[model samples]
Target: MLDFFTIFSKGGIVLWYFQGTSQIFTQSVNSLIKSVILQERTGSNQFTHEALTLKYKLDNEFELIYVVAYQKILQLSYVDKFLDAIQLEFRNKYKDDLQNSALSSNFDFRQDFDRILFEVEHAAKKQIQKGKVMKSFEESEKSKKSVKSMIENKKEEPPKKSGKGKENKPVKKTPVKEQEVKKTSSVPMATSNTSNGELDEETIRKNRERLFGPAKKKKSAADVSKSPKSPDNNKKRVKVGTKWVLGGTSEDAKELDYTDGTADNLDVNGVGVSLKDEELDYVGRMKGELRDVETESESEEEEEEETVTQKTSSKKSSGGMFSMFKNLVGSKMLTEEDVAPVLDKFREHLVSKNVAADIALKLCESVSAKLEGKVLGTFSSINSTVKTALTESLVQILSPRRRVDILRDAMDSKQKKQPYCITFCGVNGVGKSTNLAKICFWLIENGFRVLIAACDTFRAGAVEQLRTHTRKLNALHPAERHGGQQMVQLYEKGYGKDAAGIAMEAINFARDCHIDIVLVDTAGRMQDNEPLMRALAKLIKVNQPDLVLFVGEALVGNEAVDQLTKFNQALADHSNMTNPRLIDGIILTKFDTIDDKVGAAISMTYTTGQPIVFVGTGQTYTDLRNLNAKAVVHALLK
Candidate 1:
């Protein structure tokens, strides 16, 4: 026991300490055991230990605790009578209710003695009553014993002597000689049967017959019982009744392969799977596994379904379609008044621009549907395919009309003296250069003299990539490279030493060369930086470009909108650009790669009232699609 305690104490999971009075509440079994051994061995009372105690065994095995050396502590059992002694000693002890109650009620000696006595007394009374009931039974048993005793006494009495025995005793010995002669005569007759006499001939004939003919068939117990071995050859066959079998039908059973390598018989709902025996075995195992998988999947589906049903049911109980529809449409914070005028103006513009009203209404409905799953319902259980289709329908309706309005306004507000020059100026990787290249190809295809300015000189590949792109589209590309001093001088003429100067040079070159649309692509800049944004401001000041299209990536999420907002703020300092929200329009690049384009579309709406003018759907130059809102919605939803 001491060795067990020592080993257990070193295991680190056990906590040990001593407690007589002072540390009674803090004491534990593990601690008390350790303390006793330590005090005896060390001859010093300076050990303290604590065990990680639990109400139940932790991890199904060892109890956890912490034991450390401390000052002398008294033994717990030595604590004597005092007011609140029990309460203080057992304050945090492992005192189970039943054990504590039994101890306090004095169950150890008195209750056990009383309980045993009660049981013994009750048993003694029952035994006494049983003895009383059998008293009458003893008398009958005694009478039977007496009758047997009388019979035994008569049996022990001597037999009476025969009176005529004395007369017969005289002739008894004289008959011995006569008896011997009779025995000798009987012996010869007994021997005659074995000596092949008349009886022997009859026995020999029977033995020969038994060994040869007159053979009898050996019978089995089953034959005696008359049980048959095999079914009758002419008996009709019955169908095997199993889950996979069809009821009273001539058609063969269909085997199905399931997800888990188990196959099961699946009832045919439509077309049946025809398989060979080997394939059927393989499918049977697969179907069994699939059933397990489907069962789990169904459980999960049921949980999700219940959640949706509960939410829908609760909402339905609260109100009907109008209330539900109101909540659905109500997600858009713009009230009817705020949106109605916009819709009216949108309708008039679409009509003026030759857009069908049916297309416009579909766009509105689809937009509403997109918001339905997100804002109206507690559950996100909308069908993915249905939602995608609805979204596509909306984009198809809105994109073209919005594009027409933007392009028409840009054309109408054109500067007669100045050449049409637009630059996609923003931060790096914002799709600025890519959008410029795409729009240049667009303008060139539209019968315009388009010139692409490769003003992003920080990376050598930037100019090469733009030039390569222009070469593929058969459009003109203008570029230049300058060192720090010459770059500074160019910006002193009213733009920055960096992108601003390059953009200014590109704009002037386009004007002199009579390029209809000089699209200057700048290095991506952090729009949030006042210095970088001011540089863009300086470029616009010097070049006074007709349009400044913010080229944002379709995958840019809402960050593009944030940059657009700050860029507009800095651009306001420029006197040359009238709407320094020079966000004349937007070109959402890489539209093909985005799974959901609604975020990008809504971003454009929130940041710039301007619509997305163009989209780059693929890597090729001809992959650019004119951003018709309806087309974007249609393509994304589809």
Candidate 2:
């Protein structure tokens, strides 16, 4: 039996021979299982799991041939629609076994499908409830119709039940007649109340009419009716010709259609009044429309206020001005010189004006930092090199005609021209950085790509200070710190002493990048420092920059000329100097600080061959004036 059950699990051809009670039978059941699982059936797998079995008994001289046939069976959830008698044939034949298998089956059909079944059942119940309610409504309507028909029949055959219901009918008729009389009497009261409530101004006229009966020649319809009792009253009623008016009258002006007007007396007793339907409709529609508009407008205003509040909160919590100030101070390109004293003054002024210390500090720092980094930076002068260049070597290039032609050429060459690389050489506090920035601005304005190299890396704020000018001029600064592995390492590498070599490396970098102009701001040293001068001269030789600008403070006095001569001489005689070219131009800064004009004139005298290209009048970037011999003469002559 178990061997036959294995075949029933899935159908296959079974060759079986039972030897005895514990004998085993072997058959090729693989083909049967594969065939049954793949076969197409009428009701699909939902009806029943039916596996066909083919059995044969092998018999030669040693074996007898016998055959047994059965169906493999299993329990499964079936579609109710497919649970027909024909589909249940296998279950009927093996009813006891199949029922036991179904009871023991591990499949949890209800657990998985209960929700969907419940939803479908709920929807069906709701639809049935709706149908029942509709049917009830129809029955009630039918009952109402039946009651109406019975009432009509009673009216037609009043004699049939008249005697039996006579007393009850009289009671109903008496109340009905009294109700009609009461209703008639209350109409006048309602009209009077309406008149009083609506038209207080018309009270006097109304009171006079009410106090007296109808005039003999103008008796009302009510008066005429009462006159039927007396012929004299009838005569009076005929003379009065009774009349009644149903509408109100007012003495005060009333607003109608947004205009002030005396209301027309609506003579209900007569037929002269008229009304327009469109006007009433328009007024009603407009009232509702205006209410809706008002509601929407109020909602919009609330939303706007909330949005503004959110924006204000965001600005407040964002650390606004303070964060901005910090960023400005922390930038890679600003120094003490870049940030001026005016910033502190402004902060103090804000505090004096009753602004909070923290707030004022934040605002002032932000404004000053932006000014230093952008507005101030662009116009701020670390040095005034533009005036120096323009007043000297570039003067011949400044003719209006020449400038105009160059302007045109510059516009065209702007796409092709290589930027110039130059260096400013001078002692400390000579306004080298300030002048270099001013020249950078001039070049940028003239459509030149200018870059500044802060080779004077020894000063604490030297790099930052140089960056301040580049920031002000709004020029591109490609190199930040070039200490190691740089083509030009401005600082010393290890134990090496290669200042000239470092400068050459920087020059090579500029060459490789094809930078338009390289302005190397050399470290401030004494004009008589021969070793430094030699190093600088060697750098100049290697870089071969277009021009060398000499920056000196106007406060240097007569010693300024000597300083100039010394540096110029060194530049001219550095090494096997064939062409004795010394300093190309002179930049005199801080003239505004100098009280003596003679000092400036004497300094100019030292640069006999070299022209004074620029003069610093004040501390501002724009304060440096283009040095004209005539302007110097005026300031000195004055």
**Model 2 segments more than 4 A misplaced:** 1-418, 471-499, 595-598
Candidate 2: worst-modelled 10 consecutive residues by lDDT: 286-295
Cα RMSD, model 1: 36.4
- Score each candidate by Cα lDDT: 0.46, 0.45
The clash count of every prediction, one per candidate, is 46, 31
Instruction: Compose the digit string of candidate 2's lDDT tens values, residues 13-112.
Output: 2222222223222333333322222221111122111343343221211111223323445221221211232113333444464335442333323332
- Model 2 earns a TM-score of 0.32
Q: Residue 535 of model 1: what lDDT?
A: 66
Scored by Cα lDDT, where does model 1 land?
A: 0.46
Residue 403 error for model 1, in Å? 5.5
